[model samples]
Target: MPAKKNTADKKISKTVKKDIPQLYSPLLKTYFSDLTSANMIYTKIVRSPITKGRIKSLTLEDIPEGYFLFTAADFGEENYVETLDIQTEILASSEIYYKGQPIALLAGPVFTDLLDLEKNIKMEFEKDPASKIKEKEYPYAQRFIRNGKAQKPEEFTKLFSKKNYDIKGTWTSVLNAPSCNEANGAFCTFDKNILTISTPTQWPKHLQENIKRIFNLKTEEVFIRKTISSGPHTNTIWQNTVIAVMASLVAIKTGKTAQLVLSREEHFEYLIKKSPISIKIRSAVKKDGIIEAVQVLIELDSGYHNPFAAEILDRLVIAANNIYSVRNIEIIAKAYESYTPPVSFNIECIDSQAFFAIENQMQKICNVTGFLPDELRMKNFERKFSLPFTFTNEKVREAFSAIEKMYDVNRKFISYRMESKNRKIDIKNLHNFPLRGIGVACGFNGIGYFGSNIFACNQKMEATLESDGTLEIHALQPSASTLEVWKNTAAQILEIDPKQIKLNSIFDINEDLSVPENVYANVSVMTYLLKKCCQDIQSKRFRKPLPITSTKGFTSAQKKVWNKEKFSGSPFFLSSFGAVVLELEINPYTYKIYIKNVKAVLNAGKIGIPKIAENSVKLSIQHALTELVVDENLHCDQISVSFVQSDNDPTQIDGLISRILPAAFTSALSQATGHEINTIPVKPQHFFKEMISNENSVYSK
Candidate 1:
């Protein structure tokens, strides 16, 4: 990496330089700009129109002279989009599994002529009714169950029959377009068997390996440069690689630079979306509000052909029970391949559904036992921490108390229950007063990768120190904010100013660099490695060698042993506790639910950077709000968020506001409307149908 030039006339004092960080570095500004245009060819991907079918024939007889067409047959070897567990096809060869699947690549000089060529090209397909795909399935033998060792069907029936209250509900979460709307593009050029590509991605090493395998090139023959990215919480890394590989293939074939810019519509159609999930939960609880047993069945649609479906299912299974303690529980998680695009894992999207299911069950217990939502949560709160994944009950109770005190939860919950009862007795009386309700939810978000494998929980970093007292560090793709944290950490260890450090600004890590789900855990791993390097640098400061380098790898102990074959063990590394209280009102006439206010308390271990942690909490809440209630039809009238920092202990909170906010919001909506809401992206139509059904039952009585 070239050092950024100092264009200022006069240099600042060292003391002053330590206080001010260059927020926008020169290298960062130009990372996303189109770098190559001279002698470059534009390319577009031709896709399958049908959802699932077989191609009879494709015609390109009227193609222009300068244009080029490349299909799956053009590649030297078959390419598979790989994961730790499974592999899916990179390009369609014979059968197309889903709509918008890549069929062929077309490249030429003029964009309009390429469009005309696509219009002229025609294909015939034979559509099989059975081939109209529904969903792909993971193996049943890979399921994990706790305290559900009944082998006979009769014993299973007896288990459900002995409970005081048997309740069942299904929760569904649909696709949520991420906030990042910036268009994606890539450019590639080859010279002397060295392929250089520029693109913005979060998974560089994965792409490099894929390119090498596809083109039959060596690792040194391919070079990838970093670019500015909005870092949309989606599968853009894989989608961008598809574009990058396409460009590289064109450039190699034509002996010229190749580039492709996808339109916004194309981005949605081609990229994987957040898979829609359906969760059916059945539980038995005592009249005194104790959870006796629980059984949950979760099904998610992995669109098209994707091998990452198991990762999503594994996370849901881990979070199925949330933070509550139950004696007998059985969780069945299944991923079905559908016609839509495969949904990638975001922190919020992966764990939200399971949290919703568990929280919804708690609300139902309140309905049966005449307890407020907060009261029920407090009753069932786990005071003692579990092994392998330990949580501080003191922190959870403190946060829960703060939310209750800030929002006056207990009094409002009682008042709303009374008002709802009065309105239910006489529907006409509710016209003048909107239905009001308050709900609270508490849970912990697990950090690190989903499973508890020892090998998957390790990270590595390298650091070098120069004779001039400057410290240089090499890390896997770390974000700018993370780099700042690492620099400050090293400065503290070395007893020097942060300006004495030189660090790489790349934002791409190895695609499989297993760490916590959140960014802070990855930073912690880097910090641990840096600490060891600093110790080496300090010991050899004046002894012999001027420039010293140290490389180290850090791995946490496997506190919980997991059996992959049986799919049972402790799957969490560490967990951060959080609670949310949602206060809202509902229009009785229009059936529109308006969120009046939201008070949340997050207890992530310790505070390193309060501002960044606070911003993450706010963003998580905002994203969750949009996903649950603030869509095109529903509206949130008011919202407020507050953070309560834990005691200055060494522990860090895994960012978990996203998982907490949605569950609380949905529970509060159910209380406000006096209707059990099981699905997310709540709409008025669901309530309207419920209202009609209720009225008919009343008329019959």
Candidate 2:
């Protein structure tokens, strides 16, 4: 029997429904059972044990009846992985480049047989003296970027020859791996003429093109079905694509469905790790506390086969003097070859290193000149944007001020500075006293792919109006649903209830509309496209047929003109400004640092849902803090974060938070300990060792 409701109860229910806004989002699921054992066979990769070597011969102890072995010789096509660059080798035919380089693929109906075969496999190699993974001499390259007219070397040397305030510092960041929750895997099946591959990736279009070329198949013959995984950056996309291609190759050869799943250990062993970066900045500041010029030398360890080294250096140059106004600056960045596999991505590699050096230098200058960091930053903050993209001064200042107030940084910095100076004066017994310090860092991140000729600049986004008067968003990729914000944005433009807007997981259109790679940029761009599409649909709904559609590319104003040769131009669509304040307590006995609180302020333009935006920022800050302080065998760590919505500013708020927090955390710990610590994933022993060594040096001096 159906339950009955009174008139008052019905009225109350209607009132509650009207008050709460409705949101429609696709399911956020990363695990999928899309392929079953009946149709799919398990495959495992056999890798070279030596980092660099020439293959002598291969031998197999025993092979099962249904198991198959495939090597580079099996596929005659050039043994290289396809991407923006054609340099990375997929399989070692004659030589191995890295330790975990794939040597062969073994597939079988029973997964146990594949594992048994891998355990019993053996190889012989002639190890090259010059090709050792740890000792290889990587090719080197250098370039300089200057804002003013070009000066001869003699003239450049003369500017720094004066008896001025000279401060020299070196910042080094260790290898920080991307924390991937889901180990990468791929599934492939081939029909009569078409091939279907399922994998978790950011660049499905690139994968499809690479497989098509390798297999000598038509464009339509290859299909890429995306799996669900968030937080894997660019390296994951490339690594997983290689696995997908290998699976497709095996399936085509044996006429059996092939699947390859990288275990967690294999994911770490096989994929690229974040290359270490070292930066040295020498500044020539006038006695009057004005910075006249800066000479910066940056060395990045680009593991062997570093195709993206130039792009990484380009981003570093932009961040070298990011927020300050320095007219005359010389930056020399070099990419050195190393034995590890090449790694490059968004925050995990580039921006974090650049900003840490820049901001740490600012704090060091303040310590020398007796000027507050905030005061010095305000004095030197660049008011107008040049060389790089344009950003309003108010946006930067707003973010800076909000963080300062939220964290009580203004008062704490002064007290901490005085305490640090006193401790340095009598450092004989410094370990007896516990210390607390606060740090602040301000900067902005570019949205979308910028300054790179290899990445797509102009991509399209689609939005449609369904027959039932509902709006549907077709995204290029899947991510955590920020669709509440999108629905509200589209509903406001369409003059309809927010519940009527829906984001679709799949659409009946061609897969050419690959938006910018970053998730935050995708959300911001999709919202803009939805607004434009809603306007078009509203104008047509009265007279035109149902199910209208509209599409748009990034605006001319949003597109950046990049110069590949000279490496100059505005390379980003827009800048998302962020300021982070880290408050920490250092343990005197154990030399451990406890992160007490993390306060951050972001100038992400005009937030739609404040709670959702706040939660998103909190999640990223937590992740960064967990990676920074919590994971390093430390105890009692806590974090808090907030965002300030700027109606006047129009920048998106995606991965900017993750980029800014590491620098702030590092700077804070450096200030507290009175050590110039310039590194990532900072360890307590680094400072503990420094303190013990410095005590002896003080007596000798």
Give the poorly placed runs of model 2, Cα more than 4 Å off: 1-34, 119-122, 131-143, 175-180, 347-349, 383-393, 402-408, 427-433, 477-481, 507-510, 514-521, 539-547, 560-566, 629-645, 692-701
- For candidate 2, report its TM-score: 0.87
Q: After superposition, how far is residue 52 of candidate 1 from its true place, in Å?
A: 2.3
Clash pairs (backbone) in predicted model 1: 135-337, 136-336, 136-337, 448-516, 477-508, 604-653, 605-652, 605-653, 606-651
Give the local distance difference test score of model 1.
0.65
Q: Rate the local accuracy (lDDT) of all candidates.
A: 0.65, 0.67
Please report, as a residue range, the 10-residue window in candidate 1 with the lowest summed lDDT. 1-10
lDDT of 2: 0.67
Clashing pairs in 2: 138-337
How does model 1 score by TM-score?
0.85
Candidate number with greatest lDDT: 2
- What lDDT score goes with residue 89 in model 1? 61
